[model samples]
Target: MASSTASQQPAQVWDESQCVAALAQLERLQAQIDDLRLTIPRVVAPLSPQITKRPELFAAFKKAAVGSQSNIKAFRTTWQSQETQALFEHTKASLEANSDLTPGAQLPRYGWEQKEIRDRDAEARRRDGAKDGEDKAVVSMSKEERERILQEFRAANGQLKVFSKDDDRDILIHFISGGLKYRFHVVVNSETNGGEHLDAECLGNGEPFVSITRCVSLRPHANELKPLLDMIAAYKNVQSNSCAKCGKLLDKSALVPTARRSKQPEEANEKQETVWEALHESCLD
Candidate 1:
């Protein structure tokens, strides 16, 4: 029984090897047949019964053959010479010219180009005039004019006042003058109705008070004037009265009066205060 089983196993192994070899040979034969099928021409022979019976077909074939030969010769000649590149360029240009169906499509309009140039020149001139005008205006003011303006500003706002030695009036003046382009000093004295005064000094060739200074007397609780400065900066561009806190739009009539501390007290028990304000009405809501 053992010998019979061993003999059966060898027979089964031989059969499996034979099947694998047969499949490989079949695959190779199929691949060769596929290659031959692709290489073979699909068209019927020119001398086939249908073509042979038609006289016109023979004439057409002859004409096609002659034309093909001529084309081949022309291609050879052109490909072997520098004139080939020039001919290709000429053909491309001709095709491009013919492709443009629109009228006056070859070049842009002269008037349009001139207008663009003129507009640019005008814009440049306007910008230069604006820059020069600003510089001149800032530098044109005399020292006396600056002093007078400062005095007027202080008087109108009631900023001038005399205080005790420990008062922060001098510090407040420094803050205001620092905002100006020119280096001006603030002088506090008895004659000055406000607690502050500005000395004569020439600022550079820039806009006067272009910088926003700290108004220490107003909103003394605030540490920095950055919020007001930002508002002022934005105001310089768009001339609208907006709420400094909420950025809501406000009308001229919306501004109200407010009080600020003054330099001195007229009576022993009473304190002096400056009266002016521009609170946006919308802010109250």
Candidate 2:
């Protein structure tokens, strides 16, 4: 009976290669996890003034503020009388006016108008003090300022040509850059199309894709035309190196309008006027 039991018992075997392969796979998986941890982007806090400091605390505070508003609204709706509601609204308006933070707040609205008048007066003084009309209009602008203006124009027009008339609106100014002439148009009641006006094109150089483009807010500002003027001044006065895209040396003298019509008298009258500005011929597009 013992011999029969021994014959029936199976042999125990350990494969060294299988164990090594399993261990190798486990190590590889661990390394992949470690690499993933290092590559993942970390979450960042918002930089708004309200949340710049103690952003985590600000998140909690915002939640609590929202809850408080809900509670107040419920209480007002359930128990407050109509007269009380009117009084509450009036008090809220008064507080917002005093704070000068709310949109269309009385104090802020008037303050903005006053500020505009002051700025215009200051500009007029500076202009008068300058050597000539051209010098008077020369306002030093930063790259940021130029970008902001360009963006605003792009948002409205979807595409501004170097010197082509837009069928939709009136062209306000002709801008020249890199030997390319751009027409700036005034968009009346420019509305947001799916969060942006994305169709703006650069029709200068006859080819729309020659230059870099960007978008800005469609809302108008005081001295709405000044940014365009500033950009023209910058392009004319600032000496730049080779074309940003192609790295080719640009001739400043070669700058010309892209939309010059053939010598038909009627067409010539309608064609964009050629204006001299500093820009490279290849860069204008």
Candidate 3:
């Protein structure tokens, strides 16, 4: 009986090992099937007609895009118009507020006009009495005044000159209509960009008036000339090698005189010649 039992046990063990191997093989085959199922769809998807029909959809999308662009353009135009109107209204209000226009019969005095007249009267008085205290004032004045009174006054005191002397450059007084007044210093160089050279500051301001090509016919008149010259001289003396408009040291050679059509046609003539000038950036202050 013991021999029979030993033989049965070996048979049972062999059967268990075979069952385990068969189950492992079955699990591997199932895993392979699952992998195939996942890969087949990915490989065939690109070859399918449904996936390749994207070009047609894109064409329709482009047609719709045109309408969107038109809408954007219309919106931009409307916005720009509204902005312009607002700016115009604000400017008009500011002008009216500053103007001497009165609601009733009370005569309104223009503030700037009154100030200008007062300044002119004071200047006249100074000029009239200039020689009276000359002897007494000579010792009190600095060596700079002894060397050059007009030039020193312009340089130290920021007095604008309209024309250039041997020692001083010309000044340009900008009488902007619509209540804008400014001044600058300028020099005319006949050799620069076909007879054009401008102040370093004017070129740096990024304004319309800084181009040599534009200044071809712009010139200063008798009334405008002296003031412009004085302004330039004052700028030259005070600013020296710095940009008059920006107070930056700029390459003088890169500066080119530029001119633009004046905003006020009544202030300038058609045949005038424009030149370039420099100014203290602080003058704008």
Q: Note the clash tally of each candidate.
A: 7, 13, 37
Candidate 1 yields a Cα-based lDDT of: 0.33
User: All candidates' lDDT scores?
Assistant: 0.33, 0.36, 0.36
Superposition error at 141 for model 1 (Å): 2.5
Q: Lowest lDDT 10-mer window, candidate 1?
A: 208-217
Candidate 1 local lDDT, 1-285, one digit each (tens): 122223222222224223233334334444444544432233223444566546767775666556555555555554544544433343344444455545435422222322233334444654665455444412232345434544544454343331212232221222222233223223232223222222221222212221111121223212222222222222222232334444544333222211111223346545443222223322321
Off by over 4 Å in 1: 1-138, 159-285
Q: What is the C-alpha RMSD of each candidate to the true structure, in Å?
A: 34.1, 29.0, 34.5
| Tens digits of lDDT, candidate 3, 152-269 | 5446444333344433333333333223233444543333223223332332222223222112212223123233343333323332444435555532323322222212224456
* Cα lDDT for residue 267, candidate 2: 46
Off-target runs (Cα >4 Å) in candidate 2 are 1-169, 175-181, 186-188, 191-201, 205-225, 241-285
Ordered from best to worst TM-score, the candidate numbers read 3, 2, 1
